[model samples]
Target: MKPHRYQGSALLLALCCSAGLFLTSPVVAEESLEQRVTRMEKLLESQGLVDLYLRLEALQQEVQMLRGEVEQHGFDMKGIKQRQRDLYLDIDRRLGQLENGRPAVSPGSPAKLPESTAPTAPREQGNPATANPGTEEKAYREAFDLLKEGRYEPARNRFTDFVVRYPNSGYADNAQYWIGEINYVTRAFEQAIVEFQKVLDNYSSSQKQADALLKIGYCHYELKNFAKAREALQAVITRFPKTTPAGLAEKRLQQLKNQGQ
Candidate 1:
């Protein structure tokens, strides 16, 4: 009888411990869904999409690891957080694109200019097609030299006329890029972004895209649109990767995040 009584007591103790663990485990695991959602919202609002994506990925890993073991509150909390994260990312991506300025739309084969005929004439506006390709290029080069000399109006016209007349000339890439350069130097950001994008979309192979991307961001910065600026900078990092533009973009991104702007 004594032996039987001892065994029963031991069984009761084990049962109590199991029950205690089952009940308290969930309470410890739970977190309010509202609180988690609020944190995610704040992160999305405060951080750009890149930072947001990084945080969300971290949060998801946490959720996956704890899913089966946590309380109902915890379970629902994870799902809630994940859903909000997805929604936030989607919204951010779309917004980033809108503000991303123009990326290349479709690539076109860059046109090439014919060699110069000793560079005699500047503009034969009436006989554009018959104008010496080489002479036209040399003239454009001279206009660029004028720009470097701080001659904005003439340089601007030189670039404009080049594009207009030699619409199919290989120098078209260079001509378009120079248009952006002139506008950018003049602090005409709104106009400059459009012009730079024309270069990007039309001349994907142009060595100038890196500089163009950087300037696009700079234009946004000058316009006091920090978010858009960050996106443009990030694109420089993405598209150019490990270049001077990419390095500059990374520096600016860090600065923007630190300022919480």
Candidate 2:
């Protein structure tokens, strides 16, 4: 009887110990799972912050690139507008001269001459088909035509030839002026300055004087010689106050001021 009681007590103690282990094991597992989930949440929150910062940096860089493009486009538009204005003014001035029947300036021509005795003889104004093939007028017309057709290289060559061959012709100043125009249109600002300066030096009394001066200013501006540009533009304003070139200079001066240049 004592042996059986001892065996039964041992079995009861084993059952109590197993029941306690089973109940406490579930509580410990639940606590461990909750801690894993909390840690995962913290790691994800940190990763999200890093992603947000990277995205902000990318957006800032994009905004800066867009600003640069906008500024470049604005500058290009200004140049286009300026070119258009120059072309229109030049054409208008030329047409006005033709309509007024004004004689071209020549080295040997008198300051005042009767219209009938003008150097542009009837043959010079004759039909192009029958006109003298080698005449200075014809050469000038050919060069001018090439320029109008946008054949810049050929035009430059022909104009250069005309200037060299007809230095005493009535169209000498005009030829020199057109050479500078070609350089200006081609964006050869430095060379344009030299060519335009020749017009001012060689043809001081030419009607193109103001135009040449204005172009010098434009060349300097394009070359970023701001002080020289300002000086030339100011000279235009002071010397040819009411002329078209002066007006253009004023507009350019205002632009420089607006740009803080």
Candidate 3:
């Protein structure tokens, strides 16, 4: 009886050990599956972050390229405007030479003028009726030749002498206008204004009247006299409508508006 009881106890111990091993195997398998899923999720998140960083770098490079294009376009536009301005000035100069009956000087050639006996002396002031037409024309041409040669001081002096000696000549108004132009070009705005006013007051019937007024407005603008500039520019538009000077005044008015004046 003692041997049989011992055998039953040994059999119950072996059954309990088998059950414990079966349950523990399933729990270990589930833990390993969960760890594999977590590692996959971490790998996908890291890949997504890397892709986003690469895309952001691409966008920054595109923006830099666009900025360079815009700046290049602005420089191109400025160059075009400068060329247009130079062409306009050249055309106007050619037209002036034609109207004055003076031959255009070639770029490299020296301008020729009529011979004068008293080159340094100012001719005596006289009435146009009594003044020799040949002498008047020659004097006017000499002064214009000096201007075309870029001798501004000599041109200014010759124009002044022309005005003083041949005030009644057909070219007297033109001479006065050129004097003002020289002053304006030299940045003597106040003196230019005074000289331009002479053209308006003394030569109201001259073809240069409109241009003189236009230049006066320009001088006033340079002098920072906004009111006078506006007044003179407006007068040109009103009095010389359909003329080149009027067109120039309109352009200047637009510039003043852009400046908030």
Candidate scoring better on lDDT of 2 and 3: 2
From the highest lDDT down, the ranking of the candidates is 2, 3, 1
Which candidate number would show the highest TM-score if scored against the true structure?
2
lDDT of 1 by residue, 1-261 (tens): 367987998998788788886446665556556578889998888778778899999999999767655776787889668645643453354335323422222224222432421222344466756356456556666765676576878988988888876765555666676688678766788999999998778666665688678878878977889989998999999999987668867887887788797
Model 3 residue runs over 4 Å out of place are: 1-130
List TM-score per model, in order: 0.49, 0.68, 0.57
* Model 2 C-alpha lDDT per residue in residues 1-261, reported as the tens digit of each score: 367987998898788787886556788889899999999999999999999999999999999999999999999999889777876577557646643553444544443323422333232344443233346566877888887787888999999998776665556777788899889888898998999999888876676788889999999988899999999999999998999899989999998999899
lDDT of each: 0.69, 0.78, 0.77
List model 3 lDDT by residue over 122-146, tens digit each.
3355555325656666787798888
